[model samples]
Structures are given as structure tokens and as C-alpha cells.
Target chain A: NAGVTQTPKFRILKIGQSMTLQCTQDMNHNYMYWYRQDPGMGLKLIYYSVGAGITDKGEVPNGYNVSRSTTEDFPLRLELAAPSQTSVYFCASSDITWRTEAFFGQGTRLTVV
Target chain B: EDQVTQSPEALRLQEGESSSLNCSYTVSGLRGLFWYRQDPGKGPEFLFTLYSAGEEKEKERLKATLTKKESFLHITAPKPEDSATYLCAVQVESGGNQFYFGTGTSLTVIP
Candidate 1:
């Protein structure tokens, strides 16, 4: 199983540029999440979905949005990127409940100047 | 508010040194505690999951034990490849499936 996959392994954006970080999972999980990890810091959730078409905000959701129109895809969009958003972003997915381990993607390194 | 605290932010040990890392957390209706290891520039890899107080799980040289208020990751005869940041997070029983992660404990095993 391709587990979890994220695209654009690296990106550099101007202060106002917008882009989408793509994430897809083949595990048929019911839960998907997007998190950002600042250098030397732990990850903070950006958004999460319990199932396709159901999305919600997480601890840190500013400057970002997500859509889960399909069970296999959860894309995170950064609107007018800022230097503060220059961090490594990871996409993860888990099973139907909160009792299982979430699998993470390789991660996307975003740099805003 | 939910909180997670990881101790000794960073640790350096010679190969074969045995040590432990602590993770203290507070949450509403603790659902589960998860441990993951991350290498630089890489995503976290699942290590173990502890569900109840006094629960324990082991893999290779790493052992994770949990209590109501905290959890400990014990490393026995560590090797260089085992050196990486260890992260602990909790999933509140009602907090949906979102996880709040601790900053993580960086362990460096030197040869």
C-alpha cells in the first residue's frame, strides 16, 4: 500500500503566492490530518477530516484551508503565504477511530520569502 | 487546555548507554498515548501505542510505559541508528481523531 503520499516535496513561494499541498492515501482510512512542524518544534495540526466531505479546524489553522472531497485525498491550501508558514508540512491518516496509529507522509518543505 | 511536556529537550549518549525519556501530559478523558520517532527532515514513524495507565509496549531496544499522568520511553543498549527525536502525543477520547504532539525529545547516540 502506498500508505500516504504528498507532492511538491519542496516549494518556495513569494510573500503573497498561494499553493496547494497535495496528499493522497491508499489505506482507505477514515481520518486524515494536516500538520506543520516548525524547525526544532513539534507538529501542530492544521486541519483534519473524519471522513470524506467532513473537515474541521485543528489547534493551528490560520492561513490555511483544507478540503476532503474524496476518501483518498486531503489537500491543504495556503493563502498568500507568509514567512511564518515556512515550515515542513506533513500529511497523515488513520483508521475509523482515535485508537489507532496515524501514518505520516514524507513531508513537504515550504519556504516563503 | 491540553498540554504535553517532554523532558531533557535533548540528550547525547555514547553507544550502549541506557536512558529514559519522559513525557508528561494533561488532557480530558485520555483516549490514548502514542510514541513516534522522527529523523531529520523526515516524517514521524509510529513506534508504540499505550492505551491505559500502567500499559507497556516494546520494540527492539525501545520500551514505552504509561501512567495516568505521564509516559516514559526507555532505551536499552541504544545504537546510533536508534538516535532520533522521540515524540509523544495524546488523543483525547472525545477530541475526535486529532493529536496534539509534544515538542519531542531529541536523542543522539554517539559512537
Candidate 2:
């Protein structure tokens, strides 16, 4: 059903470069989230959107931005890529109802040099 | 502040051996607790969701039980295919459905 899809499965960027990670869910879920996972660390929230045009900063929002233009699309932007930004990025979506589980996209492995 | 902690950073077990993974959490008000299984280079996959204390759910050889302070994911007679990193997450009552996640437990079931 293509629950959730993320683009650019892998990418390598130079310092000061910029890129956008695209995420779209066909489930029509209202809640979308962006998270980054590092080795030996838990998934840290980067940004989230409750619905279209409503976005909020998450635990690790610095150096990242998100936009929810439509219910199905929530894209994450890296303004100035740094080596610290290298990590596996995941996009997830869930229904508005409480207690519903989130479905995650495959992932985007980004490395900044 | 809400926090989640998972024990046994890594575990190794022989096929058919049963074991349990721990997930401890502290939140002002917990809306729900979730378990996910993640394979290498892939995103976390949903496994179970526990809402209240003393609740349990089972799927195949995996069973999840939740309590007031912690949760346990028990794998009974596991197989080599069951090896993966298990993650625990908690959603707080407030903050617009934000989730706090634990580092996770890496499991290796040998055949």
C-alpha cells in the first residue's frame, strides 16, 4: 500500500550544502514526524506536523526545517549540512486518534563530509 | 521531562531460547507505550502498543506486557529470523503527541 515513502535512500553532501528529504504517506494520516537516528542513540525527533500548514520544532530541530504543505507530504530541509548531520533519517505518520501506532518510511541515509 | 530506558544494550541467544527485553519509562502522564522492531538499514517497524497497566498483547512468538513503571517484550522459542533491534517509545499526555524513545536493545538469535 506504500504506507510511507521517503526519497533519496542514500546521499552524500559536502559541508554547507543543502538538501531536502521528501516524505509522503498514502495512508492519509494527519500526524507526520521527522526523526534522525544515530548509532547507539534513540530516534530523536527533528520536526513534526499535526496537519497541513501546521509544523512544530521537535527535540533536535536545529539545522533542520520542515514543511507540511499537504496532508500527504512533509518534507525536511537541511539548510547548511554539517558533518554532525550525518545520520539515518526516518519519516513517520500516524492517525489522529490516540494510541494508534506510527508507520515509518524505509529511511534516508545522509552523510555530510 | 519524559524519559525511556531499555536494558541490555545487546543480547545473544540460541534458537528456541526464550528471553525478555526491558523498557522502563518515566512520564508525567503516559498516553501509550509502543514497541518497534528495526532491522539494519531499515526504519522501525511497529510491533505492539500498550495503553494501560497490566495489559498484554501477543503476536506469534512475541508477547508484550505493560505495567505502571515498565514493559517487557518476551520472545518465546525464538528463531534466527527474530533477531533485530527492539525499540521502546512512550507518548506523553501533552505536547501534541510527541514520543520519547529509548536507545533500544539489539538481539541476536543464533541458529
Please report the candidate that would top TM-score against the real structure. Answer: 2
Candidate 2 regions exceeding 4 Å error are: none
User: Model 1 over residues A3-94: C-alpha lDDT tens digits?
Assistant: 99999999999999999999999999999999999866799999999998899999889999999999999999998999999999999999
> For residues B77-111, could you state the per-residue lDDT of candidate 2 as single tens digits?
99999999999999888756777789999999999
DockQ of 2: 0.82
For each candidate in turn, the TM-score is 0.98, 0.99
The TM-score of predicted model 1 comes to 0.98
Instruction: Itemize residue pairs with steric clashes in candidate 2.
Output: none
lDDT of every predicted structure (CA atoms)? 0.93, 0.95
DockQ category of candidate 2: high
Give the per-residue lDDT of model 2 (tens digit) for A23-108: 99999999999999999998999999999999999999999989888999999999999999999999999999998998999999
Worst 10 residues of 1 chain A by lDDT: A38-47
What TM-score against the true chain A does chain A of each candidate get?
Answer: 0.97, 0.99
